[model samples]
Target: MLIGIPKEIKNHEYRVGMVPASVRELIENNHEVIIETNAGIGIGFSDQDYIAAGASIEDTAAAIFAKADMIVKVKEPLAVERAMLRQGQILFTYLHLAPDLPQTLDLIDSKAICIAYETVIDTQGRLPLLAPMSEVAGRMAIQAGAQTLEKSNQGSGMLLGGVPGVAPAKVVIIGGGMVGNNAAQMAVGLGADVTILDRNIDTLRSLNIQFGSKVKVIYSTLDVLEAEVLAADLVIGAVLIPGAAAPKLVTRDHISKMKPGSAIVDVAIDQGGCFETSHATTHQDPTYIVDEVVHYCVANMPGAVAKTSTFALNNATLPYIIKLANLGYKKALENDQGLLEGLNVINGKLTCKSVAEAHNLPYVTAKTALAI
Candidate 1:
């Protein structure tokens, strides 16, 4: 099997799909890996580095896309790249299709086998493939929110960790999943007043035990969420619904009621955001003011830390990539139920229930789509 790595083309996206070490692993497994020129350059891996790992370097993404049996990418393919997809070709990447109707339609028309890394689950029912990036994004949410809280950024002139005799900022995280957990870690480490809200009692209990009074864990309800958001100096929207659009927990009314100059970091922006005012922003322009509240909604937060993100992402995704290349996508997916859960589209049919439901499209189960 020939695996292709194309340079990510999303705005300010610097993470590469495969690193030199990952390519070497594939080579050791007797697989041919072709990488587009400069695919790993953003993360300091030269073409020579890939070559040293026994990967053939192609000069153009077109050639890599056209000739490779499977395409491994860091992010979802952009419009042009999606246009390049061919029927029956394998696309293994983070396809956030629920929020992006156009991309879903394009993938369906291309008739490609689309396996979303974010949707893949482990035996523990954890999102193994999405964990690395989620961890990165979660940690970065605090960093970004703190920066946005600076007076120059039009945020409340409050420090996350106040000095002696000064009060620390209140940080409210709207989920108890990976992103919220990490955000709470950062916020608490910085000496801020941290509160995390979630619907799961078990999750809230686990978080309470983990934090042990350093962070407050609250059961999420409309009244509680609104009160928390209103009181927060910095709010982090960390909600996720696995392959579905993130619920809009923070409505426009809530934004309007937020304290003047307070900031919101919507880490769930990739899944359409849990904040009503959230819109995807780029690193170059990461914040905007809405209802006097700063909104930080960079969809690819992990991309800002390209090297760490690429290596971490590779650690999680390489095993699955190897399995796909070694046994072919069908056999690999058939062997792993978790991997089959990653299948969103195959042979022009939408295989993910959430994605199909999101766009009112016809749904096909992964087993039916694969004819297993």
Candidate 2:
């Protein structure tokens, strides 16, 4: 099998798909790995590193795509990259198709075997490929929120931890999942009064056990969210709905009630955001004022730390890439239920229910699609 690794071309996306170690693994399996020239440079891996790992460096993406059977990538294909996709070729990447109709249409038209990393699930109901990036984005959510709190950034000139005579800032997190947990951990460590709300009582109970007196766990009702936003100096929206779009829990009307200068970092922006006013922003201009409320909704927060993100993402995705490469898409998906969940589209048919439902397209089960 011939595998290709392309440099991520999304705006400000510096994370590459495969690391040197990943290339070495494929080489050890007797698979040929081709990496586009300068693909790993943004993530601090030199082309020489890949060459040392037995990967041949191609001068152009077109060259890599032309010969490789499977293509691994960090992000969903952008318009230009989408145009390069070949029919029946395998694309293994974070294809968040629910919110992007154009991307879904492009994949369908290209007739590629699109296995979305975000949709792949383990038996534990956890997204294996999406977890590493989620962890990075979750931790960074707090770091980004902290920076946006500075007065110059238009946030309520408040310190997260506050000084001796002053009260600490209020930090409200919208979900109790991985992103929310990490954000809350950071907010609590900074000595801010932290409150985490979730629709799941079990999750809230778990958080209560973990944080004890340091973090407050609350039932996430509309009234509760509104009241919390009114007092919060920093709000982190960490809600998710797997492969589907995130529910807008915070509305523009709710934003109107939030205190002026309060900051909101919507970590769920990749899944179309849980905040009504949210739009995909780039790292260059990450924040905007909505009713005087600061919104940090960069779609690719992990891209800001490309080196760490690339390594972490490869740690999770490399094994799956090898499976698809070794067995081919059908045999691999047929054997592993978890991998089957990753199949958004195969040879132009929509195989993932969430993605098909998102666009009202005909849904085909992976079993049926693979049979063809």
> What's the lDDT for residue 126 in model 2?
91
TM value for model 1: 0.99
Candidate topping TM-score: 1
Model 1, residue 234: distance off in Å is 0.5
> Candidate 2 — which residues are off by over 4 angstroms?
none
Question: How much lDDT does candidate 1 score?
Answer: 0.95
- Write one digit per residue (lDDT tens) for candidate 2, span 107-203: 9889999999998999898988888888899889988998899999999889899889999999999999988898888888888999999999999
Off-target runs (Cα >4 Å) in candidate 1 are none
Candidate 1 C-alpha lDDT tens digits along 161-270: 99999999999999999999999999999999999999999999999999998999999988999999999999999999999999898999999999999999999999
Worst ten-residue run, lDDT, model 1?
A: 363-372
